[model samples]
Target: MNHLISRAGLGILVAVAVVAGAWARSGSGSVTAQAVLTGLLLGGVYALVAMGLTLIFGVLDIVNFAHGAFMTLGMYATALLATGAGLNPYLSLLVSVPLLFGLGYAVQRHLVSRTMGGSLAAQLLLTLGIAMLLENALLLAFSGDTRTVAVSFDTPLRVLGAVADLSRVLAFAGAMGLAGAVWLLLTRTRLGTAIRAVAANPEGASLVGLDVRRLHALTFAAGTACAGAAGTLVTPLVTVEPTAGELFNIIGFVVVVLGGLGSVPGAVAGGLIVGLTEQLGGIYLPGQSPLLAVFAVFVLVLLWRPQGLFGRPA
Candidate 1:
């Protein structure tokens, strides 16, 4: 009951912040409505990114610093396919997801698995090295140039008297759909049960005949595939650059911590909270970076509820 109330309270606070920020921005009812709607839509994408990060951490107990680099790879892959093969950006997901999945599985099986029982520093350094390598490879291939997927659905849609880009709405819808699918997989499927069992106790799972290493690899691959899907979804909305993944990496980490280190649902809630903070901060702080506001909220959340809004007390 307390957890439910806390969640509800957090939601209310975000709602109030959105309303107050919009009202203060221009005192225009339409503008305020637009900001709120835009914030919510963008929040969905953030949730998708954070969900990938949280899943890996929850299951594997490893901080995947290269997660965003994988996302960059996906962005490039989608861009190349969409532009070179004349495929629709969304259609390219068929290639991007599997490609990233294979890459992730190979990396975990060959590199990360070697450091499983070693010091945390080894794992961190290894993942960090992988991130650097992927980013630089992208730089060499794409030359730091910003690219975007050209899509025909660039028109704006009106909702509650507020205008929203159709692409963003579609991204939001896709993110939500994917999140739902993941939740169902985790809760309803046998594979998901094995993954969760491995997460809970690798030794126990191994004793029970589950291949712990395989599960770990599979979980990591699934997480990376989510990043791939996110890359494809955002290709039309943002400029795709090699370094674009860095910002997402930072945001994903923040969401993971803010949501609770290993809580999937908490990650979703944290993403929405961060989205609201960014939009509201943009309005209230006018000239400052919106991330400053996000960091501020992050600090307060850490101080007040270190386990996160939905996390149980340790």
Candidate 2:
């Protein structure tokens, strides 16, 4: 009875907070609901990117600093394919996903693979080099012009007076589905077992007859594919540029750390929490938003829970 009372009290507190905030903002319940949904929808995309980052970092233990660059590459690929080649943005997945996957496989197999168990400098420098190469390559090709893919077909959805573009909503749904699938894969498949095993203990996994090299390639490829999908999903909402991934990469790293190195659920939770916090803080805090707003939380998380919300205890 005591536990139940405590839980009920917490729930009531949260409800009161929500109601008070809504009353302060507009005194409209529908409007508050709208605000909440808006945050949730956008949070989905952030979660998707965080999931991919967690997967790569958690399993392979290689911090692909270039993960965001891959996402940007996907955005660019989809935009170019959609506008230049006259293909649907969604349909461009066929081209973008494979290209990103191939790039990931090649990079890991040739560069990251060689750096395994080597000096930390090698791993860092390799990924850093890849990031630099991608940024420069994009600058040279796109000339710093910001471009966004327009959804030629869209049906706007209005939920409780809050306007949401159909594309963004679809992207949000896709992200959720993909994240769920990833979690399922991580927990319920042979390949997932091998991947997790390799992540936990590479040498032991190999001793048990798992092919470390192949699994590594697959992990790299899968991570890239997640980034690619995220890029494609968000491209319509934002610009496609060379340095676009920089900010995303930073957030991705934070979300992964906050979620716990390789915990998919943790990633999703962290991403949503970060995303909503950013959105709400941006609105309420005035002049302090996004990067700056989340900085405090970032530091607190690191100091209080170094392993992140769900990260394994060190």
TM-score winner: 1
Against the reference, the lDDT scores of all candidates come to 0.86, 0.82
lDDT computed for candidate 2? 0.82
Off by over 4 Å in 1: none
Q: List candidate 2 stretches off by more than 4 Å.
A: 1-34
Q: Which ten residues in a row have the lowest lDDT in candidate 2?
A: 277-286
* Candidate 1 per-residue C-alpha lDDT over 68-164 given as tens digits, one digit per residue, 9 for 90 to 100: 8998888889889888888888888899889999999999999999989788888889999999999999899879889878787579899999998
**Model 1 pairs in collision:** none
**TM-score to true structure, per model:** 0.95, 0.90
lDDT of 2 by residue, 153-193 (tens): 88889877777889989889888998888888878999999
- Candidate 2, TM-score vs. the true structure? 0.90
Point to the candidate with the largest lDDT. 1
